[model samples]
Target: MNSTDSRASAYTTLSRDSVHEVEIKRSRFITYLFRVESEAQAREHIAALRKTHFDARHHCSAFILGPDRMIQRSNDDGEPSGTAGIPMLEALAKRDTGHGTDLSDVLAVCVRYFGGIKLGAGGLVRAYSDSVSQALEHSTLHVRQRLRIFTLPAPHALAARWENELRAAGYQLEPSVWEAAHAVLHIGIDDTEHDAGQLAAFTAALTSGAGRLQPFDTKWVDLP
Candidate 1:
């Protein structure tokens, strides 16, 4: 597939809340919290928000992204069921397509401080959803590109030259270190632009077709 066919991913925070007395705006400014590896990280975000807005009435949150959406979870805090969590979850689910296939194993939370204004169930839903939406609007999103890792082994004498050639050719090379009489090279190429013929030609020119390249797992990596 071409790069245009690639998916976009993002890192965002969940909500807006203040601990002390503060004015809250109703501009739909959800924090759009991002992917957290563990529940602990998710809680850390929650705790920090609480500390930041200690006097806020509620901190609603929802996180759904991970293996099988494995880490899916949401908290209404003190809000009515389906108001805070469900709306937040729905927002997350809507963004899943852009996140690619590995979007599972992620979490999100929306923290709301009452603002002394009661947002009814309908308003609450809009508020929660809008929070994420606003945050995403200002957030930096990245495209998740598929990369192919290859292990190339070459004699120490030719390793440095080979590495330089690959770099000059627009390939990313991992750190190469000497081991025994050979150097193991880790190379990454954008699968979307993968050209086996070009690779074979390069290898032929570099090692007279003697070098071996082993394929590794494909992964979603951040694009600059």
Candidate 2:
């Protein structure tokens, strides 16, 4: 399903691509964590890593996608069944992805650089899951906020002023547009932040009662 399919929920995921490496029994296990919106993005990352870590013996991966986590996938990449990919997936699933997040929209990969010693099934599972858990500990996460949009009208010059001040005050904004010689600014308010009267007051303060804020649409937005 598409991201839009999960409108009532927000999720937590990596703010940026992150990686960490661990050594177990002389074997190198590198974990890659990424925020992904769709299966396409997950596949792209897996393919790129396979190329980048070409010498690595395995590129086991697991991904959870969509705000509701409607899509889940895993691959062992030639490893023995139920060891690498499933544990990696579980590692990602069990963690607290952060506030207001449902732990969706993320993909994790365990790239193994085989050492002389071989880890049996149980050892392999622990290594893969541990690799992911450790990588998440070091990762920086961002919250996805489901936002309601309001289009406010302003003069061209006032648009810039309103944009700067409101954003600095921590309001989410899309780019302002010029329409019929006036600026149309789109402000995105978090689901919990919406208050019509408060917004009306803010709009008046910005435009001196010259224009008003009107309802638009709702979508997900990331906080900085």
Candidate that would win on lDDT = 2
Give model 2 RMSD, 1 decimal: 4.2
Off by over 4 Å in 2: 1-6, 154-175, 178-183, 192-213
lDDT of 2 by residue, 32-57 (tens): 99988899999999999999999999
Q: List runs of model 1 lying over 4 Å from the truth.
A: 1-32, 96-107, 144-148, 190-205, 215-221
TM-score of each: 0.70, 0.77
lDDT of each: 0.64, 0.84
